[model samples]
Target: MAESQDELSYSLKREAEKKGFQPVGIARITKSKRIKLRTDALERWIEAGHHADMNWMKAPARIEAEKLLYGVKSVLVVGLNYFTIPENKKPNQLLIGRYAQGNDYHKVIEKRLKEIGKWLQTKRPDSKWKICVDSKPLLEKAWAEEAGLGWIGKNSNLINSKQGSWMVLGNLLSTEELIPDKPSESLCGKCQKCIEACPTKAIVEPFVIDSRKCIAYHNIENRNKDIPIEIQKAMGLWIAGCDICQEICPWNQQKIPISLDPDTQPKEWILDLTAKQAKEWDDKNWQKKLKGSSLKRIKPWMWRRNANYILKNNKFNSSK
Candidate 1:
């Protein structure tokens, strides 16, 4: 007997849970007025130079779903929780965001999405499909909200009631028509902790962020070694990515520390690195050190520059 759309959606959710994608939801594709408004807002933000050097945000991949996939009827939104609050900071240690501590999530999530796509193909052989991770320009958070995965929080992150904001999102677009889930509502209300917590004041408005002042943007996206004096000073000891906003969110407080997978924790040497080792660090050593890590996106010189900034800010000398 041919299974109903509800059955297929339930089956897909089961498989996604088996694959470790918690809070998965399916959304039907439609021409959205809200998306159009967001596109206009994005254009204005770009014009205001809020995007910094990431001009790719204006690319076709950022276009609407109907444009990205013809006859696209459904979007499978999946959330993977990568939230692990670090233990107390040790003396002279650099801070790396939890998201970048593991194998490149782009690789990990996309691999799983592909597996789900294959499963869908087996069930509906005639259906066309498209898979997207952070690498793709799709506005995944909006889709996630539409799919009832979570609400877009004041920190400009998708926040699930159960998972909080410590999530990485991936999407699967398919030609098959499936039942759509109800959209999650805005739960931010009057809370403004994330806004006040930012050292660089990157969150300009309730749900908007100016990347020019974002620590993560400067550390990861800024190709130039010469970061602005104010941003550098505000950067503190973050050598890779920043997590201040997410850390300050009330929702994230509920996150219990999960087991630390070997691949997901910073290398031992990284935690105990001294000024002497940092000064002697070179490109060859940097490549070998971050071989499987996502930090490789930034070149060796950038890493050195960030480390030097931190060392200089803290006035760390070679001794001890």
Candidate 2:
């Protein structure tokens, strides 16, 4: 006998949890007004140049699910909590974003999603599946909220009531019909802590961020160019990506009960890295340290650029 949609949804969630995904939920595919509004907001954000040099955001597939997969029926969204207790840093040590402190999440999440997709195939042989991580053009966070995994908070990071904003998202789109969960409602409620706490003031307004002013964007994505003088002055100890907004969020202040996956735990070598060392690393050193990590994308030159900014900022601050 064929399983009911609810039964299938429950099975899918269980399969995802067994593979270490938390807060798994399903979202029915539809041309809803909310989806339209999100697409429209994305267009406006791009028009205002808030996306900076990420030209891929203009892909039409981001706004039209049909472009990605024909006859898509449901989206299975999952969150992987990557939060681990941070290590104390020496004054000379440079900071990296928490997400990049571990092995590449793209590899970790994709491997898990493929396993879930294979499990679904056994249950629904006719179903077609497409997996998405951060590289995809899909508006993943919107789908995540529609799946009841979490709401997008003021800092524009997905905020789960239980897991906080430290979770990375993944989606498995399928042709098989499944029950959809209720969409999450935002709980930010007039709090402006993220906006106030931004060292570079990148969060221009609630739910809006200007990537041109984002330290993470400049450090991680802006290549072959010098960081702006004003942004350089505010760089602090960050040598890769910035997390000031998420760190200041009240949603992230509470302790997360679940232990982090071993693959997502901070590597000791990454913790021991200092800005001075990053600025001095040769190509061989860069290749060895960041071989399996997401921070490899920063490139040796980008690392030097970011480290230079941090060292200059420290000198200026100490001289004051």
Candidate 3:
């Protein structure tokens, strides 16, 4: 006998938990008003050029689940808490975003998702499943909210009331029908801490970030292009990606559960890197240190470029 939707949803959540994904929830595929609102917001964001040079965000598949996975009936969203409070910073240390401090979450989460896919195959041999991490063309954050994992905070990061905004999200689109969870309601209210805190004012409005002005975007995705003078001036010591907005969010300030996954822990080598080392690293050095790290997205030249900004800033500050 086939299991009911409620029974299947409960079993799926249990299975996901066993695979190390916490706060998992299911969202049935539907063209609901909330989904339409999210799609419209994404269309506007892209139309406004807020996605920067990431042309992939403009893919039609991003707005339509069936385009990527035909007959996809549900999305199982999961959040892996990657939050790790940094150790005291030593002088001259270059900062890498907390998410990239450990192993690449794309690899870690995709591996777990693949495991879940295999588990699902046993239950429904005829069902199709697609695993997606950050690289996929899916509206993962919106689906996460739809799944009740978290609401998109003012910083545009998914903020779980219990887990905070320090999670990396992954999705599993499957043909299996599952009972959907209620969507999360935004809790940001009128707080403007993230907006007031941004050095680049990247968050032009609440829950909307302009990637052209985002430090993380320039450092990680803007490849080979000269960072705008205004952005360069605000770069500070961030060599790979910036977290100023998340750092200032009250949701992130709350007592949050840190990830216990060994793969998500901060690497001492990454934590100890300095601007000097970054500027001096040869291609060989870059390949070795950044191996298996999400920071590898920042090319050797990009590293030098970002590091030079930090060095220049330090000199300017000291001279003052």
Candidate 4:
């Protein structure tokens, strides 16, 4: 029974596949009619001040799962693969997380999401919808979980059983009915590697991260002064974002080449620069190599700031 056999959601899934949404699953976001524990988890995280300087993540948070896609009867959850070559993983070689190796995913994923929304509208002319790609403060991991995209691993990133944690999530919130997918179970069972591997102990509890100690939080969100000295050194080779927890997870062991989505390819400039060269990197080089990049969010001075710490630890030695 299609929500509108006259308008196949399954066909929408297929079209999304051709357009490069590797996995497309629909999860309805119905009104809860009652305020629930969604607020409890959010309140707990805020009360503990785990969000750190990102006070914005505190207000207007969702947890009950359906509230995110509110007023929308169905959510089309999508994932885009963004993994790249291993050689590009070296710290001295101008490293970056696999996702940010190309243009910002927010732009890339949103474009494709709107295309799906467009197709749905064509099938059902009266459909109403919106495309979201982290642009809104939705707890994407929760949405992903509900849509069977993956489990929010101990690292706090969505880890697909097949693709590891190397994908960005996108969604189409619609005011049309569709069956919701079941959430994935935690395959991480008893494996505490990601929690243990966080250099700053950011994973204070299972699936609960304290951003104050998270390198990714400090590097991108905490925009004042030099990062705390205690964690600055622990921040280590994470020039922009820290992938330490994901890297150490057993789930990421199955490495595969991402065949689609230009968003996954590694850039040459980011792959070949020696730490010394990256240090001497001029304004022109920064713009050319990292423009429209997530790195741009970190003030230019912050790059020089965080990179200098990694440099001193290696004792000015480009190879350590």
Candidate 5:
């Protein structure tokens, strides 16, 4: 590459790696046809009421990316592997989602993204930039695919060939032109394992999920005083975000365990929590243990609700 071309984004990948971001790529902004497909899909999803109570999905801000960052020339899409296989030897352990097993990813990702943004700003003194960690309305997975990080799996999670689907995505949009990498190919060939394995049949179709039937949505986003009986029964032992689809996917089976961060480990307390103890935990205790953890997003009452529901089923006390 020519010197002028190399200066387009000032070695964005190298700068991101310095801050411990991997699976990073730069993509030029344009009226991409792929983005149109994603927006159209979102419209259909919202119209079908699949978004459930997540009214934010219907907002215009989330419907378009150009409006979010007008005159945007490039997007620096990055992924951090947070996949850690748990050692749940006991049968009584409550199952919590792998993503929330550690500190809040929003905080971790944003901090790293800001550092990259600062470096890019120095390189392009006159350009504007924005750092996003799923906080904005932008289509993060779509951009990640366009940037060559990964392809959107049939289960709707981004699937990287090397890192699998166990990744947290973050982005840096800038008004500076940069060389864009070729988009990744669709690697999920005729795989229906994720769609077939869902307990609530949340994966209604390939690449589509109905939040109305999704346990993760009910447990995390649904603020209703009581969970619907059908959904609750289908929840089984999932006390937090559900990871059935990801776990079933063959892509996630092969993991570079030593490469991922150790902070992603689940707390010992979570592994040993029981329905009776979870119900007795006070507000002060809840805050103290889950102070910086993503699991704290669910209130103590909600925690008890999930635990009790699992206990009622007596299905299996298996924790993923």
Candidate 6:
């Protein structure tokens, strides 16, 4: 007879895959021991000053992650593809990572997770469940790596041999026990493209990134009145997020592209806006052009700041 637990887990994975999540895996939250180790790593990483200006990276609130899956016997992880087929869209003309070009990923992932949770309830009526996306302090990438969906790469982003790190990850921790999957081994091998491609050299060393110097960190997290002059010239007009590391990663070349939810696709105006045109953009037009999009993080003023920065820096190349 097929084990009831195994059957239910298989069903859960199938449901998630049908919903267009590229990869799905199950693992137990019975990993309290790993929690302590992660905390140690977190403390050490912070002490080494790699986290940079993101003070929240060292927040005490992360203690909850130690027990995020407590009383839960399984975690169902889902990975969704978010890549756009176009290569290097209007480069140096101001860019946001494909992930941030659409609606906020937290909302997108949570919508699908709720459906999975409801389906689980139908299957395991007595079980309790909690869901989370990147919004939480949980060591989600570590858990995903342990669940066999992928390996943690040298750039500190998770990688699947077939698909790369351009996907969003989500998980549901449940009281229902399920068959657990094994962890994946590193597939980065000797590759270091992501490290060499970083404009800010944020990947200070293998598997270690210095967030303070990262372009993504600056464009998204920083509200400083004056960005570091050197960094400002190098910002290259990235208003929201950066994808240089992932773009240079070899794995992105291996996979067949997948369909994305239409509503989450970027508007045409995103690529059409130029450094010169963006400076004249009004708030109302921006609101409509970027409706429901993640660029809302780069508020009108911030986007203008980025556009102006790009215009100023690119002026040196006008003769070309």
Which residue ranges in model 1 land beyond 4 Å of their true spot?
A: 255-279, 318-320
Per-prediction RMSD in angstroms?
2.0, 2.0, 1.9, 3.1, 2.7, 2.9
Q: C-alpha displacement of 188 in model 5, angstroms? A: 1.0
Candidate 2, 96: how far from true, in Å? Answer: 0.5
Best by lDDT: 2
Q: Rate residue 40 of model 6 by lDDT.
A: 78
lDDT of each: 0.81, 0.88, 0.87, 0.73, 0.81, 0.76
Count of backbone clashes, every candidate in sequence: 0, 0, 0, 0, 0, 0
Runs of candidate 4 with Cα error greater than 4 angstroms are: 1-7, 31-39, 59-70, 88-91, 255-260, 282-284, 318-320
Model 3 agreement with the true structure over 14-42: per-residue lDDT tens digits: 98998788789999899988889889999
TM-score of each: 0.93, 0.97, 0.96, 0.89, 0.93, 0.89
Model 6's TM-score against the true structure = 0.89
User: Any idea how many clashes model 4 has?
Assistant: 0
Across 1-320, the per-residue lDDT of candidate 6 in tens digits comes to 43399788888899998887877898776545654665677788899988877666765646453366556777888887787667455644567677876677788888888998999898777778888787676677777876789987878888887777878889888988789888777888899999988888888888788878888777777787556666777777676678888878888777746546664576677766677667778888777776777667667766777766777787534321
Give the lowest summed-lDDT range of ten residues in model 5.
Answer: 1-10
Candidate 2 residue-wise lDDT, 100-125, digit = tens: 88889999999999999999998899
Candidate 5 lDDT at 192 equals 98
Least well predicted 10-residue stretch by lDDT in candidate 2: 311-320
In candidate 2, the residue pairs with backbone N, CA or C atoms under 3 Å apart (3 or more residues apart, or in different chains) clash, namely none
Candidate 4: residue 270 lDDT (0-100)? 65
| Candidate 5 similarity to native, TM-score | 0.93
TM-score: which is higher, 1 or 6? Answer: 1
